[model samples]
Target: MSTEAKRPPVPSPSPSPAAAQKRKEKGTPGDNGADAARATELAPTTPGVRRELLHSMLLQRRFEERCAEAYALGKIGGFCHLYIGQEAISTGVMSMIRPDDYVITAYRDHGQALARGVNPRSVMAELFGRQDGCSGGKGGSMHIFDAKTNFLGGHGIVGGHVPIAAGVGFAIKYRRGNQVCVCFFGEAAVNIGAFHEALNLASLWDLPVIFIIENNRYGMGTAISRSTANEDVLVRAKGYRMDGESVDGQDVFAVRECMARAVERARKGKRPTLIEMRTYRFMGHSMSDAVSGTYRTKDELEENMKRDPILLLHNRIFEAGELTEGEMHKLDDEAKAIAQDAWDFADASPEPPLEKLYADVYADTSS
Candidate 1:
């Protein structure tokens, strides 16, 4: 078994383990009049909020699209999960949090880390396993971490980080700091035993953590229905007595609004909220399985693309005269340039030296 699968459930800082999950299940599942109206209603409206949101999503999109191409060419190693279609969830939620706030997520985390302000080059370098990578070339795609930004990790374990996030929330409460910890994971994680354990603890202790389930329909190659009995995963929250919600994951504004409320509640009283973002994955589970074999279909993929979050937000703003086609074109171009620079940096960056192999491998022996 892989090391990730062996993540022994360690004791969390909380009196008990913390956890939560969400998957947005209802929507027209199409990009049309009703869908457009829904998006408009949910969009964030403030000075430059729309533009910046678009920029953040665009950066993640372009970066991962290139990552797909690079993975096909064998640049990234280990299990590389892409966050292509789920861009809005990270972009919106991360935008709503304060600098002191914390973020912890499962392996599909490039977008969240970038949304939290990890430089494009550093992210790309990590994927390339270069010395300057965020995890210093030790952790490739599935282990990105940046303490300066409080992005706790890009954990490879499925439901492992759920409780760890609760621990962070407990520490925040212990310090009396009004900060929230947002834990991101896939729909499949809901089935893990550790998931329920964490959520129960989060509620019992009122740890300020938002358990975000980025339900992109399929839990890897298997659909949620195959493994989970409850289609609406938020129902799991009821057992813990914590309020839960399902949001339009593709609509950035909708996600931001939900995140804003959850962050406020956590910062104020350290209560945890469960949210499921209804979204889709344009790509397969990973670059290796780009098609997902017989699990998903081409027509279904085409249909979801109609409501592509990037285009949905762009068209909505342009139609309302909030932004022009020229402005959006410029933003898209800038994202591409940033991605190109990241590629260049990763290509030129050197590999980690052998001397540092055991540098951070073990616990410190110091007093």
Candidate 2:
């Protein structure tokens, strides 16, 4: 067994009155929608808000697209998971979180790392195994970390980061702080022992954690239905005795609203909540998988593409008279320029020094 799988589960903390109130409020009809709409409205009225979301999503899309190109060119090594179509989940959720909150996700995490404010150049350099890369290039594609931004890490093991997220929440609560931890995992992880163990601990102790399950319907090549008896990922939360719901992951508005509620609840010291985001992956599971695999039909991919989060948000902004087509194009151009600059920065940045390798591995025992 891997070290992650062998790690013992952490115990849950005591419940808070604020968390209980939040749960009671969630039961009210239209509460979730009202909150979501408010979030959409609260989103900065300046053109930059939409532009920023769009730019961030586009940067993620293009960055990964470039990763695919680099993988073919042998510029990047090791396992690479592309977040081609799942940009909205990270961007929308991160928007609702304060900088103090923590973010932890599974190996498919390049996008989450970027959305959490990690520099694209550093992330790319990490992928290139450069010493200056995030994690000192030791983590590579699966282990990006930025303590400054509160992004705990990109855990390579499936379902491995759950307990760590719980620990962060525990720390926040122990210190009498309001910070929340957002744990992102795939639907496949729902069936894992770690998922259940972490959820149970969070609920029983009222830890301030938001469990986000990005249900893209596939765990690697296996579909959700094939691996688990229950296809409704959110329903699993009930077993933990916590509030859980499914949302349209591709819809930025929907995700924003859900995250707001979750974050607010966590901030108030409420027990954890489970959210299953029903999204899809535009590309294969990773750079290694064939684009046209027998596991998934192209028609399915085409159908999901129709609900592209970027296009949906852009059209909504235009329809609401908030932006013009030219403005949208201009935003796209800016995003392209930023992505190019990030790539250039990564390419120009010096690799980590060889001596640095033995530096951060462990604390100094001699002292």
Candidate 3:
């Protein structure tokens, strides 16, 4: 657990229940000093924004919950990774970016695509392998894509998309466009060759991209302490001489504040950043894997769930008077309904036809 072996110390803040309840009392928004600082930095988070955040996170949570059911019912196949606990990071970061901006991530991307405005119906259709899926039913849960929303497809390989994200950033710079590319990946990917290569090139060219490392403590089933010398992924940024920061990934306000700064730096100035978000997944690496304390202890799992991002945000909503309990419950119901509707729509949609087996595979040689 001591990262002093190879890298500088990076602070990883855990979730705080006290912070969510602090704003209701008096002078500051949250009890935690860091949380209060974040609240001030994002002071303009209005009632509408709060509602949207809650709604988006809830929808993601419920959708994944449904995915688990579908997978069990033999409706979906192949690798299916859920984003059940890491919703706040996606929701908060996506809210800060524009439609023109680009977004890309690794396979655990159902929530990321939805946050980027990809229709849940199409996403569910993709999961169900229906013809109307965003990827025409070819790409399953791991490869959901929607170019129309500027959300590049999710790659299956760990660091495969890192270089591609750098290329996207380069394209924006070449065209003199005011858009930033946000590349997301797990902490495990930081050890890969492509990750360092992409960071070095991006920093050298001053490309507009934010390299977000979602450090969920485990890469598949192995914890970070067992994998690499440096436990803190942000310290890797120091080698590339890129500005980097680590934050409490479970806290939405903290994530938003950190991401807001990264976005500004990418959009205005051509500066790339490396962000290490310390979050934890409530479930196992994948549905096929055992989540019942096989590699991790039951106590560890329960302790992390206590800081669930959706519950944290809900507590803040109740504390701040942004929305009444009844209204929040109504929003939660709406989110659940959306997920259910997606399932129904996906069920009704047709399957991919056999005739189009070679569709989009090869180009015309006659030209």
Candidate 4:
């Protein structure tokens, strides 16, 4: 879908309120906001940066492919969802955020967690149900969490994390912080009550949050068209009086551009924006589901594969003179190596001990 319609007014890349106030009090243009805006304009990304973007996407692709293999081999167990074809969305959005900002997502979260800088070893370890895992192996595939990175979690309950994301945004606002919370969920979650409640509060409270709908065409076994009354999820944002737009998630550049504008709006205190990313998943909803199941035919899966996000970025970078095909292949090999290293680490890590079952289950409330 084209991102040309219902676009919000892009805010100038001005400093955050706190930064502007600080500069005003200091009686100086701290770091020169104009120059910052020029750099912030998303001018065709530098070739080096583009290469890095491609590399990140390649890493995610290889990582998830290895995850599938691990799942098949019984190395990874319990509710594993692979982000095979939706790499661009995570890489693009994550590229635009700061380290201090918050990120939360639904079950299909390996890509987002990795993009948010969660270490691959910990992630793979979590999938392997080992002690050194991010969530200490108890959370399994759907509960990847890293507080150090401010990555809230890979929530298992559909739409459950929406309200939690709102709480994070509220905390930022209450603390007078400039951080934005990017909340991601599948198209199915939009129908849930919590998703709507969160959006309404995010808009009404003026919370800095970007609600991203990864519309991969299917929610479990049902097509989104069959599940929702209106296939266009962007329209729902209007009811909450929030900015809404659609982007082609297959193209990393497009995702980055759209997210940049949204980030700017959030930083400028414009509150929430709902973005629908039109993408597809090459694999099943989980490792248990068939790639081309009864709900979707083989032809549809093959057709969508042609627009694979990683390959799209690969060709784009090549056409833009950023990296040659040979260099791309080398990067892919490096990504594979990284994934392999993560697997080896996870395989060697010990499983959580019996005593670990009681840890983190309850907080010390007596204090």
Q: After superposition, how far is residue 54 of candidate 2 from its true place, in Å?
A: 1.9
* lDDT per model vs. reference: 0.80, 0.77, 0.84, 0.83
lDDT of 1 at 248: 86
Off by over 4 Å in 3: 1-37, 363-367
Q: Which candidate is the best by TM-score?
A: 3
| Reference-based TM-score, model 4 | 0.88
Of 2 and 4, the candidate ahead on lDDT is 4
**Regions of model 4 farther than 4 Å from truth:** 1-43
Question: How many Å off is the CA of 170 in candidate 2?
Answer: 0.8
List per-candidate RMSD values in Å: 10.1, 11.2, 7.4, 12.2
Put down candidate 3 lDDT per residue, 1-367, tens digits, no spaces: 3223312111111124365555334433222555845565664487788789888988888788888888877888999998888998999889889999999999999999998899999999999999999999999998988999999988999999999999999999999998999999999999899999999999999999999999998999888999989886778999998999998888777888888889888988889999998888887798798774678998888777767787777776666667776677788789879999999999999999987678979887886
Residue 132 CA displacement from its true place in model 4, Å: 1.0
Highest lDDT scorer: 3
Pairing residues by index, what is the TM-score of model 3?
A: 0.91
List TM-score per model, in order: 0.88, 0.86, 0.91, 0.88
Each candidate structure's count of clashing pairs: 9, 3, 0, 0
Arrange candidates by lDDT, descending. Answer: 3, 4, 1, 2
Q: List the residue pairs that clash in candidate 3.
A: none
Itemize residue pairs with steric clashes in candidate 2: 13-205, 19-270, 131-352
The lDDT of model 3 is: 0.84
